[model samples]
Every structure is written in C-alpha cells, then in structure tokens.
Target: MTVESRRLDGNAAAGRLADVFAFDATVARTRCGGCGTTAPLGAHHVYADAPGMVVRCLVCEAVVLRIVRTPGHTWLDMSGTAALDIPDGDPS
Candidate 1:
C-alpha cells in the first residue's frame, strides 16, 4: 500500500503511549537515525492498523519507534531513533 494510505500523523498514537509514559509522549522530539532529521514525535508518520503501532521518521521513512501490546506485555522498540527529548512539563 502507499505510505500515504498506510499512515497517519503521530498524534493518533498518543493515547496508547499514555499507558506507558507518564507524560505526553507525542510532544517529545526525536532524531531519526536514518536521516538525522529532528522533529516532534507527533510530527512523524504513524501506522496503527497493524498488530501494533509503527512510528516512522518524517524525512527518511525509517522506523523510529514501534510498540506492540499483548495480553500480558507491551513491547517497545526505538532502534531507529538516534535521540529523544521528552519535555519535563515545565512552563519554562
């Protein structure tokens, strides 16, 4: 399928991510290992129709994050992310 038809903006994954992260994970910035493009996690591409969620880089289309949930566990893999900056929720 075409990438456009297979993906949505990362905001769609926020609810699922909230179960794992205490903060709003979508606001976090991530650097792509494949292209070095840095942007907010919510700005990336997300595919949620699969068995799990697949987050891809905005520039290189590389897999930046993956999360799979089973009856007893949640698996998270971020091997394609070079860096991640999560906001501390500070007003500053």
Candidate 2:
C-alpha cells in the first residue's frame, strides 16, 4: 500500500492568492491627474463593470492613470485622451 499527501501552509496559500491577484507589469502604467506625474501604477481589484482602474502616483499617491482590460488587450487611457491603446497579450 502507498499513501500520498499534500499540504499548503499559510504562506503558501497567501502566495497563491498573490499570484492570482498579481497584475502584468508590461501592461500597467498610469499618470497622476492631480500631480501630472508619470509612473508605474498599482493594480486594484474593483467591481467588474468599472471602466478602468486608477493608478496611484508613487510620489503623491494621486491617480496618475487609468487602465482597462478589454476582450483583446489592455488599454491605457490617458488623462485627456478619449482613445485607448491596446497592448499585446491578455491584460488580466
């Protein structure tokens, strides 16, 4: 007879959650609307229908940019632009 078992500790579980919630760095970028600074944006899990997400400025914590994940690619919508640029690969 043979027995096999698998176990996951708290850190392991947390790591998995982090992996699931992790965002792609290549498709993430935002500009602060309040501070007018450009920097890498943070990924936030909000409602499903939200147009996009607000990226906070590293210096000021202001919303620098908005990114939206669509059917094909991730769109980076600037502060004053109505058009969105679709990046390669799955945004989510």
Which candidate number has the best lDDT? 1
- Clash totals, every prediction: 0, 3
Residue pairs in collision within model 1: none
| Model 2 error, position 54 (Å) | 3.1
Stretches > 4 Å off in candidate 2: 1-31, 36-53, 80-92
**lDDT of candidate 2 over 14-62, digit per residue (tens):** 2223333354442334444565554333331112224654434445544
RMSD of each: 1.9, 13.9
Pairs that collide in candidate 2 are: 31-64, 31-65, 32-64
Best by TM-score: 1
Query: 1-92 in candidate 1: lDDT tens per residue?
Result: 88688689999889888989988989999999999999999999999988889999988889999999999999999899999898789887
Candidate 2 lDDT = 0.38
Per-model lDDT: 0.91, 0.38
C-alpha TM-scores of all predictions = 0.90, 0.30
